[model samples]
Target: MKITEQEVHSVAEIARLELTQEEGQKITHALQVILEQTEALKRLEISKVKPTVYVLPLQNVFSEDQLDKCLTQEQALGNAPEVEKGCFKVPRII
Candidate 1:
């Protein structure tokens, strides 16, 4: 499918994009190519293929979360430039 200049301009307006005439032409051509490729892909034979989310094999590789010895308040705030009531203190924000 070919994307027209007017169609590109309307799409850009809806998307709030500011495209020059040259940019609009480039985008239109790219969109047309993408549409053609998608249409060609629709003709592929996949009757026996399963509709899977991932193209490759998937596996979980994460380790179980474990807690370690944590720092004391004084040790945690020791590097702060300012400390008050055993905690780091900073300028107030609205």
Candidate 2:
């Protein structure tokens, strides 16, 4: 699982990154370490462990939805800096 200098350069090109020689070497070494660590983890035995989606149980904490009255059009538009034809107006994009 050794990462090579060429591989690092290839990845840098794909990402449109400009890496100095020292930075490229450092990245290659770091990638090698990560791959080695992942390989080590793959050797661990966890056959008896149960699969879990979350580390802790999750519950909905929000209150139930209730019908509510909304503001009228004039009330909603009252704070607008600019309004036209009963709606907010802004500069044309095109």
Candidate 3:
């Protein structure tokens, strides 16, 4: 697939980038090469291959949940910069 310099320029506009004519030409050629490689991949035979979320055979690694001692409310707000009504107070974010 051939990408045009105009298309590259449009992308630059969307990304708020300022590019020289040389940079636009380079980006256009690079995008064309990348698209061609993907197009070539469409001809590969992979009907029997299974799709995977990752390359590895991943398994759940989480440990079983167990009851544990809990901290008091004061402990949680101990190192807070500001406290109001026994709770941490942070600047309102509008």
| Model 2: per-residue Cα lDDT at residue 6 | 92
**Per-candidate TM-score against the hidden true structure:** 0.46, 0.47, 0.48
The TM-score that candidate 1 achieves is 0.46
Worst 10 contiguous positions by lDDT, candidate 3: 55-64
lDDT of 2 by residue, 1-94 (tens): 7789999999899999999999999999998988988999668897888887788787776877898899999999999999999999988978
Order the candidates by TM-score, highest first — what do you get?
A: 3, 2, 1
Off by over 4 Å in 2: 46-94
Q: Is candidate 1 or candidate 3 better by TM-score?
A: 3
lDDT by residue for model 1 (1-94), tens: 6679889999899999999999999999989988888998679998988898987797786877998889999789989999999877999979
Off by over 4 Å in 1: 46-94
Better of 2 and 3 by lDDT: 2
TM-score of model 2 relative to the true fold? Answer: 0.47
Residue 37 in model 3: lDDT: 89
Candidate 3 has an lDDT of 0.89
In model 1, residue pairs whose N, Cα or C atoms come closer than 3 Å (at least 3 residues apart or on different chains), thus clashing, are none
Better of 2 and 3 by TM-score: 3
lDDT of each: 0.89, 0.90, 0.89
Writing each residue's lDDT as its tens digit, candidate 3 over 1-94 gives 6789998999899999999999998888888989998998779898988887788777887867998878788898899998999889999878
